[model samples]
Target: MRLLTRFCSSFPQQTTSVGARRGGINTHNTNRHYNSLNASSSSAADQVPVLDPSSLSPSLTRGIHVFNCPDEVGIVAKLSECIASKGGNILAAEIFVPHKKQTFYQRSEFIFNPANWPRAQMDEDFLKISTRFKAVRSVVRVPDLDPIHKIVVLASKQDHCLVDLLHGWQDGKLPVDIKCVISNHERGPNTHIMRFLERHGIPYHHLGTTKDDKREEGILNLVQDTDFLVLARYMQVLSANFLKAYGKDVINIHHGLLPSFKGGNPSKQAFEAGVKLIGATAHFVTKELDEGPIIEQMVDTVSHRDNLLTYVQKSQNLEKQCLAKAIKSYCQLRVLPYEQNRTVVF
Candidate 1:
């Protein structure tokens, strides 16, 4: 997948907008450094750092921080200094400021040793900075600190995206923990996909939409603790009330270039239009119907040689890849919601 670019908190007192030079550093050490405020009554000024910088391990845990606030000077300098003072090493950083909105956006990944840097204290310090800047932010500490995002995928008769995600998760290509697969099938269970899921020890639920079946309600019950919901080729329109209950973490895959060729038979629409480009879009589901923040999109060339059937076949392939890519990016905490119903995936 193409590495798309651009893509959290509170504040406290005793913080000044001090200037510090900003530079980049690359390292692989997984150790996190932390010191607690309550661990000692002595001021931070009085305490000495006992860590021998050279003795630190090579592997490091990643802590990703995202910030959105009004555009200003010295924000990066202050943030970098705060992290450095806490013994955190910057790994990767990206920033953007929209001219029209005048909002500053930053996404940064840092590495630190927990034994040296107390996680609680680090949070407190970051919170202080956030409050000072009047910013909204989220901090995700990966591998050790952040919880594995639990996902429940919903699919219907179509199974290409579902199957691709299963294979990716089984092969360790997808990192999130998939809790279960829920399907709303009025007819019956799909034996092919069910058998594959059973072989992999993944739970499968077939919620039939018969008169006596409370399938939609049952599906809502299954989503209680899930971090997000994936609509993998699930051919049902979610009700606005259901979406409000689920929050904005629902992801959907559309089979054609969005803002055009939307709704059913998108491939047929594209063929009818004689469009040379066919694409798939993976986006967050909103009440607006296929008009949500797009996380990932992929397209390919089509021609007169391609008929309706061929167009659909090619578009289905793109759908699988695009949806999987969006899910993986989200699981890694690389997707950020931006203004104007857009997204930044790093």
Candidate 2:
């Protein structure tokens, strides 16, 4: 079965600007120019404020709970009632009902004194509610200083997206603990990407693949402990069985806007098609290649003057930006899967 079990959604809508950080350890300072806190009002009914992960503080943030079940009345009311009984304050909530499927999806955040609402007890109590609705649920307790999501990045020879993610983590831009970097390509021992990762003390693993190797077995072992997997332009095609085994939390950055230009050599395809707008899509990886639920998408206008090389360069930049944005949203607990093939990201 295709499971939609994942974390809650919605970051603060308002965030302070973060200037680009210069390279090298001497230039990096954690205190200089932190992003603004992404706190929301006490009521989930109010508009959600945007949150900058760099600006979060432990005293002000709340925990998010994601729940989905067969559509019926009082799911929200009952859940809210339970939370209220536990002295939890609803900070923000997003709910959706896919009419055709008769299913409900909800992501809600609440502030409660942990001393009063212990996680173990809360889970025990919530289980009854879940069973009553035949629900599937996940709770992500996000403390201000904690790295709630752990990521493992998969890359190939192309390191643009991988480099972007690494730098973002180092500069305190993306709110995730990068567990490690895995690459199918040997790329030799002295590649620039290897030197850069080693300079920053990030773990890098090279798993060279042969045509007959059981590559997926090794990958599965590596990612078993990770919360999510990121395909930072990894060129290998994974089988449907592999996707199912991995729990389907994998996020991939496609260089082309989906449904228009898909598969290899998208830039060349777009150039031949003479499309005016070129774009990138970030989505959950599924068995059906490039057809997974999309989390975020971005586009850039193209002109006749732009040749294939120029388009490639510009689209590479877009790929980095789009993937980073989607990763941030995923880590912030603001992405929700809904309506079979769609996602609702707040």
Candidate 3:
């Protein structure tokens, strides 16, 4: 938005010496007159251009802009032309149209030179483009800080995964803000999870679930204030309504390789199956359980001596790594949803 100008210069010098000896006084000045002449001559050479932010016009900030439009050749062409006219560049985009919805969504990063065009004129130009394409627009500024993503973690009586996340956040290893911790079970008021939250000053919500709809209600309430959701070993299955309400905002870390040991006791199931590798998957929450778009997945080799306990340990480690990676990708806006999955640009 603001620009600064810099200047550099070089100056020549001369030396003069004055001394008094026993028999005579000696004085010497070499090139003194020449140095003064040269200094005067080079006075203009030291002058540099000055840039005043207040005197100049403002420029547009860098950010991402999302557009939802119709899936038609004419519409796409018109959109592209409009963007180009406004000097907007498309960095990355994905188009998804299922069935006859006729809806087209795109995410693009563009540079808005506010210095060239005033803020009002810039908005006016974008408004005209939106009207021409009959689209909805949303702009997100490029984060200037540490870019810590706000994550609302949900857990039910599980401490290992939640503890790992806590430690990661505390050590600055995970660029995340744990907005709150929601749990379905009441492990007293002084449990490990509660104590960790207290230590970090993060809010902890204990939404005890009893009825069939209780879990859904609690999860929905917790997600209301969060930018995204992280299910860190939450054993309960979320209701269909909850998943639809949150859409792709929810991410789950499954302790087993997806499309294989999906349900319960996945580690034991893997060991029983004599699988050579044990791993974890981090995926978006969809209508179908464990079938959402996979953001990240990792696996570790397993030997014959690996028992159920060893497999669980390995799986937990993999789960933390995969989930953290997925969260980081989401925060960086590098994960894009495609047909039943996601494309991680980074």
Candidate 1 deviant stretches above 4 angstroms:
1-59, 186-190, 210-214
Which candidate's lDDT is highest? 2
- Model 3 steric clash total: 5
TM-score of each: 0.79, 0.76, 0.63
Best by TM-score: 1
Cα lDDT tens digits for candidate 1, 20-118:
112222222222223221135367666544445346576545677777677666677777788888788775566655435556666777778777777
Estimate every model's Cα lDDT from 0 to 1.
0.71, 0.71, 0.61
lDDT (Cα, tens digit) per residue for candidate 2, span 84-131? 898876655655554356666667776666677776787787888898
Better of 2 and 3 by TM-score: 2
Candidate 3 local Cα displacement, residue 193, angstroms? 2.6
RMSD of 2: 11.1
The lowest-lDDT stretch of 10 consecutive residues in candidate 3 is: 2-11
Name the candidate, 1 or 2, with the larger lDDT value: 2
Candidate 3 lDDT, tens digit per residue, 1-346? 1001111011121122111111122223331211122244356665332223234334434545455555444543454455567665443333333334455445545444545545556556667767776764433435432255677888887678788889888998776789898888676767777787888799888787775556676567667756778899888788777766765477788876677888878888888889997788888776677877677778899999888788878888898888888777666565543333543232
